[model samples]
Target: MTCSEWADENFYLSAESAYIEGRWETAPFQVAILNSMGNDEIRVVNLIKSARVGYSQMLKAATGYQLQHKKRNGMILQPTDSAASSFMKAHVETAIRDVPVLKELAPWFGKKHRDNTLEAKKFSNQRQLWCLGGTAAKNYREKSLDFIIYDELAAFPEDVEKEGAPTFLGDKRLEGSAFPKSIRGSTPKIKGHCQIERAAQESETDFLMFVPCPHCGEYQSLKWGGKDAPFGIKWAENNPRDVWYLCEHNGCVIRQHELTPHFAKAQWRCHKTGITTVDGYEFLLNGQVSETPESVTWNIWTAYSPFTTWERIARDFLNTRDDQGKLKTFVNTTLGETWDDETGEKLEWENLYARRETYLPTIPEWAVYIAGSVDTQDDRLEIKIKAYGPGEESWLIGYKRLIGDPAGELIWQKLTEYVDQSFQHASGAKMSVGLICIDSGGHYTDEVYAWCRQDPMRRIPIKGASVYGKPVANFPRKRNRKGVYLTEVGTDNAKDIIYSRLAMQAKDLTKPIKGYMHLPMVEWADELYFKGLTAERKKLSFVKGRRVYRWECPSGVRNEPTDLEVYNLAAVRIAQQHFGLDLDRARPEGRKNQSTKKRKSVHQSSWL
Candidate 1:
């Protein structure tokens, strides 16, 4: 069957009415694209759209066309099972029931349940629509498919290399077809993935629904401008009449113009231009859109909904305001902006204490030995002590927010004393300092690093710890020594382990260990998971032929406390591995104290 034949048979005239009613362009475009795809000349079609522009319906139309006209296996893969079910139930069923041609062509369409599989037949050809999740992509390589649809392509898991690429799946489906057409469509979610690949393959069309200028004969795309464009309702208020139009070119002296009787007769146009580029989407410092030299075409579809009222958006901003008058999720997601600093309210210290208290009693007696992390700064030191069992359970024993010059000998004295005192409190078997992960992140790290490199009375074990693994060396023999202990620690490598452990634990959603309860850590873990950086590994590179490793922190935040927190966690992990501590056991034998006053002195000077 030809593309036009299929369109004439099944495409609904109501689709045009929907478009005219300023509802969604999905119904019309879906029918049009399905008609185009039935042609042998069209190999692929890409759709780029603003939010809520109805790409889902278009996808369903393409799927329906394949089922009715083609006699081959079809597949639709979504990033998740839930999304696939929603798409099938919403659009596929709508097409089958509402479009009379499809109901007559494929009798089984609406009868299928929203499960893993759906089957239908038209004439003598058999068609199957399987909604598989991303995980099943690799296992289906043997199936010859006639059609493939990737839904919510951007939100596809980052491990596409493991899950398998949608393009590869689409190609595999087209293998035996005499005339195969693969249609891809998605809103811009992130910078890369299926949307990017499809956009790269096709010529972009600026799908502007135009309105005629009242005073001039020119018909152009309409946009909110100046005080008329003021956020939300201001644009509607300034232009009172919904007929205002402006020239697309910036810096044009043209002002607000009305639609006149003669000019209103022109038709809306969708111009085929070049592909959309990343730079075309860049916003200016003041939050206005910027114009760049790169000429990329966009199928720009503005919302048919009333111009978002500035008052409405402003009220949304005010409603989400924190104590500091900052809009929490509004400024980041709605405004399409980035933050220069971490502006959201930090988790309250009291809340952290409360969560910690609930989990404290479960600490096993055998996990008495503690590992400490010291994040050194010029003015103050951030210290964290954690207790771990032989297996998975770990606890945050104690953390100190200490003040005073971190570089001074007195801080080290205080740290050493704190360690000794903590051991004394846990006195039983042996309470020994297993590992100390110090942050050599700043310019003055050398001084503290040298101190850590020094032997601690043959009692407290001080190992040189990196993110990836631990490297051991003797304590500094002299105070002025600089060569041996100073080494670049890979922060990324350490964070990878910390984040992986946290992710695994989060998936279980069980209560955490008792001694290590910290509300702040839980909040940080949540943020990291939401940003999809939970198990992300560090990337290694070469600059000037020298090896370097880097880490990307979770999105929507900075990397200070998280870095320090991971450093501490890594130290405890290393300690557990080194000592063969049984993390799974309810109680393990505690470490025996080998420290005298000298050990105490060292502890006081290092971390207090």
Candidate 2:
């Protein structure tokens, strides 16, 4: 019989009238379920829809169709026994009392048990609809039904190892008959669970509803809630008007207009218009039509009622700006798209690149060179070799990253390699070998100091420099004196040199000094500036007089290779003091005899 005739005889008269007058859209879900069941080829069907979207009514319709046309036992599983009872009372009982056609088909409709089972045999077609709680472990054992409907599958409880109750029931239903068609439907709870599973198994006949776009004729699924669209009201203006016409494509110019036929044909196109596989189900299930709920749509079926206007949304987006006049976090979370960071501060990659570019090529050859720096975990040693030119330019030449933690024999080996390479690069450069800074800031500091004292490499004239700004005399006195001839210098003095060079470079930013001798120095200096170490200061006491403030270490936390830059600066200072490479003019008096001070402990400073 026609839907109108069947509805008139079996359902509420008002429902029949609504159907006849086209007041309701033909429940696409009902047609999908019916077609899948009648064909016998589709054994599973899963439905998902927004809340209050007439899913229950569609299920009732499906139940009526099954009762009128086929003799088959089916089970309807609800998340709880209470819900199952409510379904029976609201849907099953109402259908029996209100539908004359269903009464004729099932004479025992009102006379069946409401708790677990209902059976009717008086009609021409004998069938039963059993209700069960989804949590009941034994419910599947009691039913050899041709059909099963699992509702609210998202909340089904099961062992974490197993799929869930819906899949468990689906497996059992498959055992009943090859032609059995089961329906599972629920709202999504997570990315990889029941909704995802069922969506994975859908077929072409599986109905996915789409509202056409008023412009561009594209079919789009509407996204009405979540962090992006926090206005939970489903409609645009909250006036029971349709508001589903926003374009999903980035940079689309379509705006919300009154639902019209011309606009309907332009927006909202089905994602699976020609595809024919269960695999395509995932695309449709996860797809959202609008990035925000206030989007415009064609008037096919208003997913949201009482719509909000686009102008208000745009204005809200604009007004919610940060102190910088950029969108605030709320705007980013709601309308503007930006990656969220847990830390309040942003790490600027451009700054890192800029610093690296500025200091990589300007190191000079005629200078005193020394490699120094600290090491972090995984041999990531920040080593820098500094050389002084004829003037104020201190060339930070060689920066090396040694593998592994900063301590131990491996570091010494890498240091040796770096020194050899640096010396070769600066061959014949007349510069005194001064202090090689070694950071003695942690547990390994004593060991490093001891190694510097005991190793034969001490004879190579490499002085140990500390990273933290402790006095050079404060470090532990060395007992063994047979290895590398090491002298300790306060890192404060080293930082002084670095900051001085940085100040000079900053002053020359507008018209940067040219030549390869200036490039690496400028680049390293830029890195220091970016790190906020634009200057260094030190409070000192003269042997006979008053306190004095001298340029100390550059300000800021020392990162990788920054200590190396300090070592380069120190070497340049030493070369200027002794070798004259960093001096502005020839010393009137011949260079004073460069006396070697006792290898004092290099004070650790915080410059690096």
Across 1-608, the per-residue lDDT of candidate 1 in tens digits comes to 54434544564423422343221232222333444444444555554444334445445555666777665467777777676666555556556666665676554554554332432223224456666665455535666667666665545654555755656555676779766656555444422233433454454333334444444445455442333232112224323333223445332223232232322243323344322122222312234443321212224333222324334443444455432224323423334222223211223323333333333323334343466667666677766666654443456655565778766788778877765553432222334456666666665565665566664322222233444343322233433354333323345455544544443323222433333323333432344322332323343322221223445444555344555556555555544444454445432133233344322322211221
RMSD of each: 17.7, 20.5
State the C-alpha lDDT per candidate.
0.45, 0.43
Q: TM-score of the candidate numbered 1?
A: 0.41
Residue 176 in candidate 1, Cα distance off native in Å: 2.7
User: How far does residue 51 in candidate 2 sit from its true spot (Å)?
Assistant: 0.8
lDDT of 2 by residue, 1-608 (tens): 43323433444523331223222233332333333333344455665433433456556555665667555667777887788877776667666556666677655555653422432223446566777677766665656667777776666765322535455655576475655757666554432334423443443333333445554555544442322343221333433233233356432334355433332222223344422211111222244322211111111112322223544443443344322223323222232122122112223424333444343332223333333443333445555555443344345455555666555677767665665452332222223223454554444555566545643222212244434454322222343454333445555555544444443323333232322233343433455434533322343221111112333333455444434454444434443343333233322122123222210111111121
Error of 1 at 230 (Å): 10
Candidate 1, which segments miss by more than 4 Å at Cα? 1-39, 69-73, 107-124, 160-163, 192-246, 249-298, 304-608
